[model samples]
Target: MNRTARLYALVEELRAAAPRPVTVAALAARFEVSTRTVQRDLQALMAARIPVRAVPGRGGGWSIDPGMTLPPIHLTAGEASALTTALAAVDAATPYADAARSAAQKIEAAMAGPAAAAARELARRIVTLPRPGDSAIRTAVERALAEGTVLLLSYRDAAGHESDRAVEPAGLLAADGRWYLIAWCRTRRAGRGFRLDRITAAAPTGERAQPHDLAELLSGSAAAGAVRPTALGPLPVAIA
Candidate 1:
């Protein structure tokens, strides 16, 4: 493999062995490279803000922080199809090029031979429907989700009067060509859904909200919204 490909593979190894430190010497031995080369790779990872730390002394090596999850590399055929389609749809959206290019590179780097060729071919052939205007609310929701923080939102009602609300953002959901925030509202004291377009301003509250049972919240909300009570009982569903 080339140096760049080998470096990517090394990152995978370090991330998989996270919280269990691996020394530069050990990595060099695995890749048949010099210890200096391994150290350079570690430096590259640190520059990317991957949370890699080097320990001091003979027993020390390098390690990633626990709970750091890399984006999944192993994609099934169905998943690959879905990703290509989604990427095509969002291709023209603002600042989407960076994420789309990054995803394509990761997939290409991870796969080999025929599989890589097929993925590229599929991506080339797909087309996405054009969407009008910027999706600022969707972008804000994603940022909040990634940082694990609450969002303070200024929302405008149908009549155009504005009100503020604090929500512990659980996740973002795309339904019927629009994005929605599936969140727990502190003011409402219940799980609520907010249409992204209705939001005027969203700022991080600088407070990390406590994690809740996402499945329970989604289930109860769905049950409450159901048109008719089930004859037998509430149908079981898994959320999150």
Candidate 2:
């Protein structure tokens, strides 16, 4: 791998193999570089203020600070329940499911004392069911909203009509065991909510989602009217 990739890989390796120092010779051999090069790379990482440390002696090596790897998250018992509760409502096979699971793990890992026990106990009692194909639309709509990009979508509506349209996806809502994409439909010249299951494909347009339209969606007044029982209000993004 190139230096940049190697540097990042080194960090991952240190983080994963942490508490157990990875010897310089082992790192060099793993990266297919000389000992000197590995040493310089480690120094560079340290100089850049990455939480790396070198242990001494014959068995000693390099290690990353475990505390440095902790994710920044803290949740009240109610907050934790609400989050895991919402996530449980979504399908486990969705594209973002693993991401949600990992975030949940990190959130729990960051907790300690009584809070952690409560979270773990509550998690045992709460279960959310997910629609199998809801992941596609969720991933697409979320990306479009986050990047402020237009999306080219192949959508099948309620009547089973299939059509391709370029849409500016402004926001997303999950309601009644379903997912919806709220977007400015180029074909209809209006904002519409398309069901997640109906989307066959979604591709980014590399164009900016119009500011006014995005603002209109973010304003809640316009987006709320886009779909029934739609709660398009901005919610806190916990871990993911």
**Pick by lDDT: which candidate is best?**
2
TM-score to true structure, per model: 0.65, 0.56
RMSD of each: 6.8, 10.7
Off by over 4 Å in 2: 1-89, 92-98, 134-137, 212-240
- Model 2 local distance difference test score: 0.73
Q: Which ten residues in a row have the lowest lDDT in candidate 1?
A: 223-232
Q: What TM-score would candidate 2 get against the native?
A: 0.56
Tens-place lDDT digits, model 2, residues 35-141? 99999999988875678999998789999987776433446777776666555444543546655775576456545677768777777787655456655556766
Output the number of the TM-score-best candidate.
1
- Whole-model Cα lDDT of every candidate shown, in order: 0.70, 0.73
